[model samples]
Target: SQTIHQWPATLVQPVGSPLSLECTVEGTSNPNLYWYRQAAGRGLQLLFYSVGIGQISSEVPQNLSASRPQDRQFILSSKKLLLSDSGFYLCAWTGGAGAYGYTFGSGTRLTVV
Candidate 1:
């Protein structure tokens, strides 16, 4: 079976700090990975996506970045965190042959103080 893994579940950081979030997909190959953020009560905003290794595309201009090191692993990082950079971060993947939609990670609730 295929599964997605994300970390920390919840986080609380100061106004300026470093952040690293990771996601990995199992039982799939050549998957399409995506990173999204949801504000307190707003819709989702795509931060970045990768069609293949070293092929990331950014959708928003936030201070966040994403990377795909291996075929099934994806990483999101920030050199310095900001107060407005708090939200629910999600990592999703879609590339199977079936009609199943994207499978998302458990999500990380980030709060920057």
Candidate 2:
């Protein structure tokens, strides 16, 4: 019965504006969390991940950052968004057992102008 929640389904922001996207999980504890971005007709790109509260790992160096403030909460933020940052952002999680696939959020589509 685990579920992931992401907000502001779609957003359009001016270049250099700040951004904040949040994801949280329920019915689970200490799940492996991740953030991903998908561009037009492209595959998902791993952004950040966390294994535990206050522990985060970045897959690529970019203008964005992520944090795990709680065991089941992850946040992605940017101080100044770039046009290149526009994409579909998703939050996902694994049971850490590797027995099944990941559970993904509805995703946030960001457009920078």
Candidate 3:
């Protein structure tokens, strides 16, 4: 059996609080990882994507950062939470690039108070 790990399924953070969400894709190497944000009744927004270690691309100019420390690990962190940052966070992994190969995590629902 294969195992995957994702953290902080739900979070209630203050306006000025710090945030850290983690996702890992085990049993795979050099996988493409993506972080997306979706607002209530709104379309999805791609936040970050990493194709390799130390390589990250930002889709939107928002208050968010993503890091790929290892070949199979990705982390999303915010220095300080903002009310606008409240949304549903999704992490997905794929074998390089392909719409059919994408596998998403459980996702995190963050609400900034």
Residue pairs of candidate 2 with colliding backbone atoms: none
Error of 3 at 63 (Å): 0.7
lDDT of 3 by residue, 55-111 (tens): 999998988899999988899999999999999999888884666567888899999
Clashing pairs in 1: none
Worst 10 residues of 3 by lDDT: 94-103
Q: How does model 3 fare in lDDT?
A: 0.89
Arranged by TM-score with the best first, the candidates are 2, 1, 3
The all-Cα superposition gives candidate 2 an RMSD in Å to the true structure of: 0.8
CA shift at 112, candidate 2, in angstroms?
A: 0.6
Deviation in Å, model 1, residue 77 alpha carbon = 0.7
Against the correct fold, how does model 3 do in TM-score? 0.93
Task: Report each candidate's C-alpha RMSD, comma-separated, in the order given.
Answer: 1.5, 0.8, 1.3
The global C-alpha lDDT for each of the candidates, from Candidate 1 onward, is 0.91, 0.95, 0.89
User: CA lDDT of 105 in candidate 1?
Assistant: 98
> In candidate 3, which residue ranges exceed 4 Å CA deviation?
1-3
Candidates' TM-scores?
0.94, 0.97, 0.93
Evaluated with lDDT, which candidate comes out highest?
A: 2
lDDT of 1 at 106: 99
